[model samples]
Target chain A: MSAPSSPVPAPLGSRVPLAGLAVALGALAFAVLPLLVPTYQVSILTEILIFAVLAMAVDVLAGFTGRTPLCHGAIFGVATYVVVYWSQQGGAPVTGVLLAVAAATLVAAIFGLLAIRTSGVYFLLLTLALGMIVWGVCLRWTSVTGGENGLRGTVRPELLAGHLPFYYAVFAVVGIITCVMWRFVRSPFGLTLRGIRDSESRMRALGYNVSLHLFLAFTISGFFAGLAGALYAMFNDFVSPSTVALSQSVEGLLMAITGGIGTLFGAFIGAAAIIGLENFVSQYTERWQSVLGLMFILIMIFAPQGVIGRVRDLLTRRR
Target chain B: MDRRTFLKTSVAAAAAGAVAMPHVARAQGGPIRIGLMAPLTGVVAAGGREMVDGFNMYWEEHGNEVAGRKVEVIVEDDAANPDTALQKARRLVEQANVSMLFGNLLANTGLAVANYVKGNGMPYFIPIIAADDLTQRNRIKNVIRVAGYTASQFPRPLADWALKQGYKKVATISQDYTFGHEQCGGFCQTFTEGGGKVLGQFWHPLNTSDFSPYLGQLANLGADVVFAMETGADATRLMQQYANFGLKGQIPLIGAMNMTDQSVIRTMGDEVDGVVVAAHFAEGSPAPVTQSFVAAYGKKFGKLPSLYGFSMYSGAMWVDEALKSIKGNAEDRDAFLASVMKTDLTGSPLGQTVKMDDYGNPIYDVHIRKVVKNKDGKYWNEPIANYPNVSQFWKYDPVTYMKQPPYSRDFQGIKKS
Candidate 1:
């Protein structure tokens, strides 16, 4: 099915006090969750935060550039493997994470340079192929990657030993990353990319280096995504071919579209809803996938623009 | 029809109830909680489900209580993903507060879980995964495997039996994962040590659908026997293609346990006739415990248990024996570990008494069986030979085995027998 024809109404004008109050209340509630809830709930929240970061990276392409990458998870997974391999070889954690992010961004830049020449269906297919190549390497390079047995034994920092401490660390990291991404999408570069999205030929005719802007945007997104993946690999202390599989990439895409495109906070809200439903629903019934699918269908049918987008439209119309 | 509106309301109602109800019912329990982490939904879902069923049947038979305490089972689906397995295990240990962990079916999941339990000091039992590293390179204090032979141990008897049958030269076809590498390496190492010539060895990628190229290469090798180590879908496809390639009876076929497992045997029919394998569990054993288990499992699940199901059932039974000896108080961790390590699992369907070595790997009989139609006119693996009291290293010294490189595709060290 196609995206909704009507675009989301941007809330970029003078800040409304009601929206600010809602944001404050949401932050307060999230802060108190670990203090009150069970450890399992805190773990679920950690997963949501990681996926939210991943969704924001997807938004850079799908929401801003009007290009959907089917292999962004592969980029994320490549960084994870890099960090895992480094740490397994007795490298320090800080250096391992840095090296991982740099490697992942480099791979993403190469991907963007190759895929920038293609558009539409070709872009999606090319990214899919690239992602599968990462998975194939992970599965075939048994000596280094452990093949299908998966690589384990990464050390977790003692500072983040407890569940609450890890959750807070994840919260702090994702919060800082999201704020930077917010400034990025609001910058002149971001706006020019949006214009290119509307009419690339017109932008090129106006002497804009459209290809260079798109490539940079893709690389920057990949950098932040690599950061997210490195944290995820450390959090689980394990890395496998599944982390880089196509299913994970599609999962990120679904989280972005289902949360609301073009909105930064909406990615987190979408992540919270999806991860919460998946973890919670599976507890009561093994047919949780069916229920999750049902929820997705209902959302697509009624709230075609996504839950956050639909809410924003209602508020805009009321005002 | 306002389907959108209806769906919207139903979705909201269902989401609110399903998502919110579990948290509210979190009162502390009275039973001794045992957590089972298995692949409930994935490529290995069928085997996982059967394993769960086997454990459940045994639990019910014992009245769902052990040593006068109510037994509570917390079932978590890992979906066969190593990352997910670790997450679910953490939830089980931290949230469910389970006393013990059980049933990790896949190899990587087992390794990851083994690592987690080792650090956390959780009492864990692995029933099915056969990667040799679990008992060798990755062995820890609190973890033990009660079911199935290690990948290296499985091929010892099969290689010896093949040599006894006068098949000297051999060709091997195995998947390229850890299980595959161990299987091919173990068989080749042992077969060569038995005064046999290795004509060829081929390693195929996991989930390979087309085996014609591998088969053609094997057909040209002129070996007297072909030893294979494919499992599940790969095994079925390889056997079917082997038949079409007209090499079924021209050369004898032997393999690790899973080549003719219960899950794939019926689909193979006469194609597997006279094919020999070394497995821990065989359906045609005539021991009283074997007959009873077969009858009860068949009655309960409408068929004989899959190797996974039987192994898990045996694992649960071991847990029961341990629990009875300790009277269900799992609080003293060291005492419980001692009791579990000393528990004797003898006189079962597996045909001999079982004991754990220093690394918590089982030392039991490995049945070298050949497939044939039984008196019931059904295909069964009848034991043609036995390697009793075999350890994980298959008679190799533990220190020397540890000194050698762990089995991989390129491994070439097998001591002369």
Candidate 2:
């Protein structure tokens, strides 16, 4: 049988200049965004970047491995709690980051081990159950997690205390992570994951350790999610049970889907759309939730493959 | 017109309108803009609406002007999340350009906003958040709780009453949170100090749909009285389930603030009657000030104003008093805060002359109330007893209290007298 075609078409040589120009222009806009907007809007932009990292994590498993893990919110939440807990205990920021990411990676490894054996809906259910367990722990473990009130008193490192500086710090971290994720999804290991997504049995017959590969992909996704969570904990200087709630997981998934699953950069677009709509739309109308719901429905109907996916489809048709 | 020309014309119009809006607002004598943040669209939306209504009612009575300045309240929904509350606080201060900040429902949101406002030096008045640290260890000068009590403040009176009634053993079932812990801690501290034994304590997560599990365990505890701490929907469900489990009248039921609050009691049936609670305000108060406030609120909203509404109403009065003293010049932040701190409200709906303590918390009477159906056949909190001039530290020395850690699940303040 012939090899399976890639979901995204290979970039045309003639389109290279346009893509490079677009990338450079987008970067320039983001770099100067804080200066253009009000301080409050800068905070909103920082939140979008952090959440975009979370969306990218969700896309990693859902778009590449064909496994939609519902527990990444819990993974992100664990890191947030770790950072807050560490800071509350007077730990340094660098060490807090190390501990937070390590804790998140460990939680992800355990969840992956339990879930990698299952596929399709079973995998989703298991991850959901694990996520619920984490939520329950966050709620009941009153001392460490601060129960429902959550742990407060997180001091931003003295260097990035100001709003503009903090926004840039988040921008830099998210920028680096995005580059790393971009490379990860295109690597040979990422190709095998995609191959498994297309035909798991075929990949297994080809002597690939499917569970191990899936486990590694899940852990890497958790690492990025943890980094985002760390940034979020610092940005908000607070963490609560809402961070680990089921709605958070669903929102991350929605962002990935709305941007274009499997397209890493689409996560950023999706994050911007969701964050912008939630904040700015509410300013204009009290029925903003209804407006948001309506937008989601329109997107699903008009662009089922998401905004980026539809754009790519249009470009392919032109060819 | 063609599409390009039409677009250009509309864009120019929109830009002109945007630029002209603030000038128009300023032309209206620069109304005293207060940013009111509440959980307007979340689990506590009902309570949040009541807060806004109560606050607005005061301004409405004065024709939307306070102290000769047109009061424009820009309400932003925090959705009961701390992060969202902080963001809204920033938007209110930096973008909306509100001179003052008011209204927060949850303790976490209150603390988050208080911290942010403290840094920004905005005058924030909390009407209904009961977080202890807001006025205790971490008190911020710019942040004042105008018409609110600490979570533990009201419970102290209830504990004293329970002991006077000769109840020797007590059990507590509270929502597992800081608010819950503080409420239970205060009660237990007073009860144990008076030789009452706390047989057991049970905590359930917030928004717990079912109370059967906790009720079943409580039945076995066989305490002389059971003190419950819950709020909003959880309080309504717990009261209903307590009766359903056949444990309602078997043991005396005492509640912390908000369990039998007007907001929750309105939703509850006869199962909640006779339950004792401690709160700063009782809607069924016989005082002339409360009666008039209740009559006006009922005539307009067609319901008894809950504690949420009463607090905001009184909080508005406090702000009005302060603004009137300073000639409505909220632009002078230091003078505004000084005027606010010196406020002595005599006709508050809380049925007391409210005054601020040194710690930026209110010092007022906490009423021991019982749930009862009034002549209108509607349930309301009826004042049974009053603890006059109650403070956040209760009877404990302020220095000693500050030295001790804030109340938590592990530290229930079981004083070994």
All candidates' lDDT scores?
Answer: 0.81, 0.85
Question: What is the TM-score of each candidate's chain B when compared with the real chain B?
Answer: 0.92, 0.93
DockQ, candidate no. 2: 0.36
Query: What is the C-alpha lDDT profile of model 1 across B226-264, one tens digit per residue?
Result: 999988898888888888889997877888888888877
The interface root mean square deviation of candidate 1 comes to 5.1
Residues A1-319 of candidate 1 have per-residue lDDT tens digits of 2233245345466446866776677567677777777777788788888999999998888777777888889899888888888888998888889999999999899999988787678888998898899899888888898888878755567788788999999888987898899889889998877777777898999999999998998899899889989988777788889899998898888888888877666787788878877776666667777888998899888876676777877787887
Error of 1 at B42 (Å): 1.6
After superposing candidate 1 on the true structure, give the runs of residues whose Cα lies further than 4 Å from its correct spot.
Answer: A1-8, A14-16, B1-29, B412-417
Evaluated at residue B59, the lDDT of candidate 2 is: 85
> Each model's RMSD to truth, in Å?
3.4, 3.8
lDDT by residue (B241-352, candidate 2, tens digit) is 9998899899989989788888888867899989998888888889988899999999999988888888898888889988888888888989999888889988787667
For each candidate, give its TM-score against the true structure: 0.95, 0.93
Q: Give the TM-score of candidate 1.
A: 0.95
DockQ of each: 0.50, 0.36
Lowest lDDT 10-mer window, candidate 1 chain B? B18-27
